[model samples]
Target: QQPVQSPQAVILREGEDAVINCSSSKALYSVHWYRQKHGEAPVFLMILLKGGEQKGHEKISASFNEKKQQSSLYLTASQLSYSGTYFCGTEMAGSARQLTFGSGTQLTVLP
Candidate 1:
């Protein structure tokens, strides 16, 4: 099943911080985070594995809790360039490894 993200949209000023959450009903093996600007394809942000292994930039951090089957994206010191639509893709355990993305969270950073 596709994961569900909270706070479908958020507006932040430069240097602000925000948190986006993704929760799935099924067991998750990995959670992938991507950001897509308007008129552009989604760009990979990070991936969190079931064992708490993380691969991504330091500016963007995420956590995956196997027990809760949930993940959260932490956007720190937000910048205007950060404005975009964020999506969380989920890979369920015992599945084909196909990623099912959440609806999306629109983040707008104002100067």
Candidate 2:
């Protein structure tokens, strides 16, 4: 049950902005976001809920659309720290906090 993330790669000059959308078909109990730097493990970013609860991370926000079974991640004023691969994971039925990740989206911030 892999969720889908759009753009695959978003190029942004410094101080610019972009949006990465994530969507899932399965009933999502929660959604998680992580960013991975080159040759490194992904760092936990944040999670959103089916009950309109949001937790984890800072300077990042996401929303869950129960009607569409989708979520969108908002990145404000792109920074160099935002440069990396962003992925969203969704929990499937009977799955306990398990995450199925999209292929990934490469985000590059230019100076």
Query: Could you estimate the TM-score for every candidate?
Result: 0.94, 0.90
23: Cα error in model 2, Å = 0.8
List runs of model 2 lying over 4 Å from the truth: 54-57
Instruction: Quote model 1's TM-score.
Output: 0.94
- Please report, in order, the local distance difference test score of every candidate based on alpha carbons: 0.90, 0.82
lDDT of 2: 0.82
Per-residue accuracy of model 2 over 12-78 as CA lDDT, tens digit each: 9988877888888888878788899999999988878787564434566778776677887878777
| TM value for model 2 | 0.90
Clashes of each: 0, 0
Best by TM-score: 1
Clashing pairs in 1: none
Residue 32 miss distance in model 1 (angstroms) = 0.3
Model 1 — which ten-residue stretch has the worst lDDT?
51-60
